[model samples]
Structure formats: C-alpha cells, structure tokens
Target: MTPTPHDLPADLDVFLAAAGWAGATVEPLQGDASFRRYFRVRKPGDKTAMLMDAPPPNEDPGPFLRAARWLDANGMRAPHILADDAARGLVLLEDFGTARMRDYLDQWPDDETAIYTAAVDALVRLHDLPPGPFLNYSMSEYQREARLFTDWYCTARDLYVDAGGFSAAWEAVLGDLLPRQRPGVTVLRDYHAENIMLLGALEKQGLLDFQDALVGHPAYDMVSLLQDARRDVPPELEARMIDHYVRAAGVDKDTFLADYARLGAQRNAKIVGIFVRLWRRDGKPRYLELIPRVWALLERDLAHPALAPVAAWFDANVPTALRESLGGRFEA
Candidate 1:
C-alpha cells in the first residue's frame, strides 16, 4: 500500500522538506526485526534515497553512521550517508538498488558459488583491517548471549534449569574459544544473505544492517554468514566457503574450525531463545515457524567436540520433543 502523508511520522514531513525531497514519493520497504522503519524516496527527476526512521530511546542512527564510515574507509560498500536529523532519529542514505543477495540466489541457485565466493572474499578483506574504532566483542557479551537460551527458550517450554550452572558451562567453553579469536578484527555481526545486496557492475556487493558491527573473533562473522538462521546453506557450499575463507585468511585451520563450531552453537542457541521471546513476549508468533530450522542448526553446532559442556547442558535441560515443537504451529 502507498504511504500517504498521514502514514508517516510527524517529523518526517519537515525532515524531507528540508532535504529537498518535500514532494518526493515514499514507498515503504521491508524492514528488519528492529524498531526501525525504511522507505524508498523518489524525486521527479529520478533522484532517489533510502530513508531510515530510527526513533530515539529505542534506536539511534549513530552506530549505523559510524559503521558506514568505517566500512567505506576499509574499502567496503556500505551505503553513503546523504543527510541526517540526529535529534529526530532520521537519516537519508544512498540507494543501493533492489537486488538483495537472498532473492537473487532464490532466482538463480546455480550462481551460489559465485556470489558466496565474492561475499567470503569481501569479508576476508574486512577482517584483514585493524580493529580500532569498533567496540570489542567481549567474553561477557558472548556469555550473556548464550544465557538467553536458558533465560527465555526454556521458559517457553515450561522448564527451568540452574542459571548459575548454565553460566558456568558456557564460561568453560568460551574460556578456550575467546582467547583464540584473533584480536583486532572487525566483525560484522550480521553478514548473512538477507542483509547483503548485489550491486551489479558498480560494486561487488552492498552491505546493510551493520550498526551492530564489533571488533572480535573472525570466526563469528563467518559462521553468521554460512550457518544462517533464515536460510539453509547447502553442506557442500558451506564447506567450500569455509575452506575458501580459511585459505584466503591464512589462519590456523584447526583453531578456526573449532572456534567456528563454538561460535555457531553460541549464536544459534541465542537465536532459539530470541525466537521464543518474540512469540510469547512480543506477540509476533510467525517467527516460531523458524524454530525447527534453528534447532537443527543448533544441533549441528553442538556436535563439535568444543561444545561438549554446552551440549551436555542442552541434552540435560531441553528435551528433543520440546526442541522440535513450535508454539504457533501447534496453535494452528
């Protein structure tokens, strides 16, 4: 549906008018899980921009702007910041066009290797840079994320586990994994297909949703891309990408693989908790449908020897039946 004047935020009209797009057409765009809203703005003469509405107290454009500058400086293709009204929580960004990597791959599955290879190579380049200016992706941060599984997912199942015990189990696993994460590397926390865009001949790819970028383990971003929650990356392709990244980055293979598994399990576990939270707490039940896929991914990650302690915790606390069930699916 077309967004009329009344459909926009009160400040949006004045904000656009001040930016020379007062009369531009606004087309609502697909948004992420965050509170932010997005719109495609088009002028009469074909000038275009993407408007980001990130209301304050809940969301801000500062991290996004900083990340964009950092990526651009490091030879990456994050959207250029055109204008901003920081107080009103709005920013104008360069339009990277309409080809998301997810949709593109859906249409041409054969191009999987080509696109994924490009993505891996691009990420390798980003990882090679110095990690200053980005916030450290810390041990506490990792631990807190892992605990989200026990905090929310278990509650959804009407089960309870010793929170203190869970924290200790994660501490043991992360103690070994965290030190191995090559310090001083930029980790784009969400490097998955959906947040990546195809830029045709102009650029290899365009990045979106990088406000959460951090400086930490190289493996964190790699796992985020390969073991995506929303889509299944074929086993052969996942292996190829992992090998390609290992080769290009010139790192110890054994450590990288171990850390990949550790981090993968960590991320997927946190996502499981988050999915349940989204359904029961936020009243958004559609995400429950993805629980089975997420559970499968978590199982794959837990198979690694590095995740033994956490795996034991899961085996003891979360039953197989509970893991496979989705509240919304059952409700239907």
Candidate 2:
C-alpha cells in the first residue's frame, strides 16, 4: 500500500529513531516537480541535516545515493549522506544551507558573472572525470525526450503535429554528434540554478537533483545551466560562459557551439512538454507561466544551422502566433 502524506511523518519518525535522530525537529522543505519530499531536521547542539523522503513505488532513493557517492568520491560537492534507508526511501544528508544559486543571484545581481563563470568551471572539472555508472544519453533517449514537445505541449495546444517526423528530425540532427560524445562525461541532466547551492565562495557549488544523471556530451550540462527554464540568463553572459568552458576544456569552438545549440533546442523542447504535463496531467498550472520563456529560448536555439531539421519541423507545425500566445491561456 502507498503511504499518504499523513502517514509519512510517522514513518519518518521510525526511520529517524532507528538512525539515532529520534527527536530531531522536522520542518518541511519545498518539494520539486518529483514525488519526493524533503525536511530540514534540527536537534540540540546546533545539529542539522536534510531528510529526503522519496517514498517507494513512486520514487526511489537508490539512484540519488549512487550518484551522490560517485560525485562525492570524485571530489565534487554533492551533499554528504549521513544515513540512508533505501527500502523506506529515507535519507539523512548534511545540510548545505539556504543559499541556492537562483536565490543568491536574485539578491545580488552584480555577482552573476562571477557565479556563472564558477558554474562553468565546475562543469569543466566534472567533465574531466570519467562518466558515472548510468545509461548512455543515446540517440533514442534524445529522440524520446524531444518527442515530449509533440506528446504533451502540442497535444495541449490542440496542434496536430507529425510525431514520427518529429522523431526523425531529432535523429537527423543528433546522429553524427553522438560519435563525438563517446565515453562521454557524466551529464547532470538538471544543472540549472535552482538545483545548485552556493556553499561559500564561487568555487563551492553544491549539486542537487542529479538522480537522473547520464553519460552524455559535455555540452549538455552547459546548455542546462545557460538555457535555464526557471530563470533568464543574459545572452551576453551565456556566450561568455560558453567561451569560458570551450577555452578551459580546450575544445574546438565551432563544433562545441553547434552541439550546444542543438542540445539547447532539444532540451527546451522537452521542457515545454514537461511544463505542459505538469499542468494538464499533474494539475499544477503555475508551470505553464514559464512556457513563454522556454519558447523564446527555443526560438534562439532553432536559429542555429545545426538545429535546422528540428527547426523546420517546428516551423511547419507550431505556428509563431500559437507559440507567442501561450501566456495566460493554460492557466484558465
């Protein structure tokens, strides 16, 4: 039987006691798009830790634990796992504190350049390590993800698009690129600002929500950081960060730039479908408000010659007016 929210606290208490955190005061933390829940556990003597309640069936703690171990062993700043009960889906983790990269940048906009540069540098370092024990971010996976646009967004907008053509377009674009990404680096699929924590200085970026990590192109995480759906990264800043990574990693500028653009379009398209699904299927309408921003990013990405096949598909199917008018429509 699935555990409801009401029974979760009781289960958490049992897990906490078994883990020797019996009386830790638990304060609920804001959850993400997934079914997992988090709580800030506090006890006397200034002890504090994060409680991840990723209940079984709907969610699992295995991937998160595996990824966390790999990252921590690699000298990256994934939160330290203090205790874990994977069966019940409870994990006690070291608290990274309240300064998320998104919130921090909002408070001090002047620090944007420095922080983003550090984020790019972090990716540079991450890519240097061998790929983690995860599935390859293969052509089929890319096609499947890109099809989310046609699956959810197009359906929500009542657009009759050629789903097969959509998959074919992605294949044509991403086919040759796959060879360049062989033995690829670990791509933290969700490497945006909200999932990153500012630990202290620019060098200490704490990673979060990386359970879905995959071995993919180095450029993929760079796109995730710069072409964020939740926040607008300045165009000039985005370009500079791209250059920073290319120079630091010593990759050919033109090739990396092309891959970056292609991945950006693909990622943005997937996000469009995900946001729409969040509303239509999950009954969370606020995600729809971000569609316009994602559309703008997608338009920018589609301008690249590398994304022409997919771009052509969009042009013939998704009309400009329909894309622009997504604001305030789904909310109703």
Please report the TM-score between candidate 1 and the true structure. 0.95
lDDT of each: 0.84, 0.89
> Please, what are the lDDT tens digits per residue for candidate 1 over residues 26-78?
89987777789999999998899999999888898899989998898878899
TM-score of each candidate structure, all chains considered together:
0.95, 0.96
Worst lDDT run of 10 residues, candidate 1, spans: 323-332
Q: Write the residue-wise lDDT of candidate 2 on 1-332 in tens digits.
A: 34445846557777888878997788788889988988888888878999998888999999999999999999999999999999888899989999999999999999999999999999999999989999999888998889888889888778898888888999999997999899899999999999999998889999999999999999999999999999999999999999999899999999999999899999999999999888888888788888888888888889999998988998899887875664225743
Q: What count of clashes does model 1 give?
A: 0
Q: Report the lDDT of model 1 for residue 37.
A: 92
lDDT for 261 in candidate 1 is: 88
